[model samples]
Structures are given as structure tokens and as C-alpha cells.
Target: MSTHDVKHRLRQLRGLPERVRALEAEVQENRQLNRRIAELTDIVTELLIPLEARDRDKVAEILERYKQGL
Candidate 1:
């Protein structure tokens, strides 16, 4: 009805595009970070593959020795 009201509504509509772009950018960044996390987890899992054992005592002993200055 008024010039000011129309201008305010247009500004709000224009702001929606900027907000959408920001959300899209954040989604892309999250995807990349998730991929990196998976890669690092796999690498660490591979490195520690030999450390997994059915023997609890062996794991405990190793930790104890490490805590008591080797």
C-alpha cells in the first residue's frame, strides 16, 4: 500500500537468496569434512589393526606399563 512497506518487503525477499547461498556453502563444507573424517578413521584403524586382541590382559598390561614410565 505504501512505498516504504513495498521497499521493506523487497529487501526481505532479496535477503533470502543470500541466506540460501550461505546454507548451501555450509552443507558442502560439512560433506567434505565428513569424507576427511572417514579417511582418517580408516587410516587410524589400519594402523591399529594389529593392536586389537581378544586378550584383555595383554591390553591392560601394555597400558599399565605405559602409564608407569615403560
Candidate 2:
């Protein structure tokens, strides 16, 4: 390895910290999005319970409750 090669490698590594920080921020955003998706999925599943049971009144009740919660 020559001095010029070592200097080039050092310069390349200089930006690694910023790159890692950007990637970490992206990962955090993705996690939050995934969590929101899971919560919506849960709400959808709950809403489907009444449909599966074929109870219109229960479905209406559940929908009202969900609306109030939101």
C-alpha cells in the first residue's frame, strides 16, 4: 500500500459517520411506519370480528367505539 492509497482510503472513511447517521434515521422512520401498519391491522382485525359473527349491531357498536377512540 502506498501513501496515496492510504490517503484516499482515509478520505473515503471520513464520510462514513454521516452515512451511518442517515441510515439510522431511515431505520427509525421505517420502524415507526411498521408500528403504525401493525396498529391499523389490529383495528381492521377487530372490525372484522363482528362481520365474521354476522352481528350487525355489534359491528355498529364496534365502529362507533373505534371512531370515538380515534
Candidate 3:
């Protein structure tokens, strides 16, 4: 093609790597966030089990341990 077209294409190609890096970083961040959500969900479900059983002592103990962990 023409020189101008070639230069434009070259600039676009050079930008591709930076864009890919940003996208990859976003994907990794999303994975970490998803994992955290899953962990919290598990903890909540565990807490619910004791509550559903009307186990006040177990629930309190779990809450205290969880608070200390934070």
C-alpha cells in the first residue's frame, strides 16, 4: 500500500502489546476478586448453618474467630 497507510498500521501494531497487557492485568484482578467473593460466600454459608440450627454459642464463637482473623 502507500507509505502513510504503512506507518499508520505500524503505530497500531505497536499499541497492541500495551493493550494486551492491560487486558491480562484486568483478567487477573477479576480472578482474585472472584476468589474472594467465593471465600466470603463460604464463610457466610457456614455461619448460616449454625444459626439455622439455633446454636447461639457456635455462632458467637465463629463470629469471634472471624473477627479476630480480620
Candidate 4:
């Protein structure tokens, strides 16, 4: 290969580690957001049963727990 091509590739390689670290941080943030969404989904699912049954106490309790979690 030409020296110019070799030098270009080397420059790109030097930047890869920083790019990888930025991507890792983005992935970590996405994971945490996904986990929070799952938890909220579970809480909503749990709340639905009590709400359908017209059980005020159970609904209140579930809401209290959800609030405390936040």
C-alpha cells in the first residue's frame, strides 16, 4: 500500500479508542433508561389489576410504593 494510505489508516486507528469510549457511554445510558422504562411498565401493570377491581386500598398502596421508588 502507499505511504499516504498507511498514514491515513494510522490516524483513524488513533481515534478509535475515544470513539469506542463515547459509544460505550451512550450504550450505558440507553440501558439505564430501558431499565427504568421496564420498572415503570411493571408498576403500571400491577396497578391495572387493582384499578379494574375497584379496590381503592390496593391501588393506593401500589401508588405509594411507586412514589417511594421515585
Candidate 5:
């Protein structure tokens, strides 16, 4: 309606693309972090079960798998 309002809207629109890209990058980072956390959780659980049963061979296997993942 007003000149000032129109200019302000245009400025906001100009910045929108950069803001969207930033948000997309942040989302990708979060996904990667979540995937890593899940992998770690699985490794811990595998180690715990083998260790509880005193299965050295199984524990070693699990550790090797974790190393390979890294």
C-alpha cells in the first residue's frame, strides 16, 4: 500500500533465497548427526550383549565392524 512497505517487502524477498539455503544446509547437518548417533547406539548395544555373555570373539567382530564404519 505504501512506498516504505513495498521496499521493505522487496528487501525481505531478496534475502529469502539465502535464508532457504542456510536452512537446507542446517537440515542436512542434522540428518548426518542423527545417522551417526544411531550408528553409535547400535555399536554400543552390540558390544554390551557380547560383553555380558563373555563372548570375546563376538565382541571383537563387533569392534571390527565399528572400525570399518569409521
Candidate 6:
């Protein structure tokens, strides 16, 4: 085979592992981000209301000052 043909075949066949590694890294990053979102959602949905209500006066005071600044 010609050098040119041999080089072309090698180039086409050599990139599989690198591409697979890149895709696996992205999948892991996405999984971590998804887990964080789930944790935050659970906090907001299941725990935030009573926690806020227990300190309703403080929350209202903070909101009043925040509104005044805005």
C-alpha cells in the first residue's frame, strides 16, 4: 500500500479510545449536576416551608428590608 493510504487508515482507526474517554467524562459531569439539582429540589419541596414558617417573622423582616432596597 502507498504511504498516503496507510496514513489515512491509521488516522481513521486511532481515535476511538480518546473519543470514548471524552464522552464518559461528560456523562459523569452531567450525573453530578443532576444529583445536585435533585438535592436542592428535595430541600425546597420537602423542608423549606416549615423551616421558613418557623421563622416567619425573621423572613418577613428580611424581605421588608430587601424590598425597601429594591
TM-score to true structure, per model = 0.53, 0.64, 0.61, 0.61, 0.65, 0.52
Between candidates 3 and 6, the lDDT winner: 3
In model 2, state the lDDT of residue 13.
100
Q: Which candidate is the best by TM-score?
A: 5
Each candidate's lDDT (Cα)? 0.74, 0.83, 0.83, 0.83, 0.83, 0.76
- Residue-level lDDT of model 5, residues 1-70, one tens digit each, is 8999999999999999999999999999998998889887886776655567667787788778767866
Provide the lowest-lDDT 10-residue window in model 5.
46-55
A best-first ranking of the candidates according to their TM-score comes to: 5, 2, 4, 3, 1, 6
Off by over 4 Å in 2: 49-59, 68-70
lDDT of 6 by residue, 1-70 (tens): 9999999989877987898999999999998998899878866665555457668787677566555754
The TM-score that candidate 3 achieves is 0.61
lDDT, candidate 5, at 60: 80
What pairs collide in candidate 3? none
**What does candidate 2's lDDT look like per residue over 1-70, in tens digits?**
9999999999889989999999999999998998899887977776666557667787788889877876
State the lDDT of candidate 1 residue by residue for 12-48, as single tens digits. Answer: 9999999999999999999899889987786556434
TM-score of 5: 0.65
Q: Give the TM-score of candidate 6.
A: 0.52
Model 5 clash pairs are none
* True-vs-predicted CA distance for residue 56, candidate 2, Å: 7.7
2-68 in candidate 3: lDDT tens per residue?
A: 9999999999999999999999999999989988998888777766555666677876887787678
Please give the lDDT score for candidate 3.
Answer: 0.83
Badly placed stretches (over 4 Å) of model 1 are 1-6, 48-70
Residue 59 error for model 6, in Å? 7.9
Model 3 residue 26 lDDT? 96
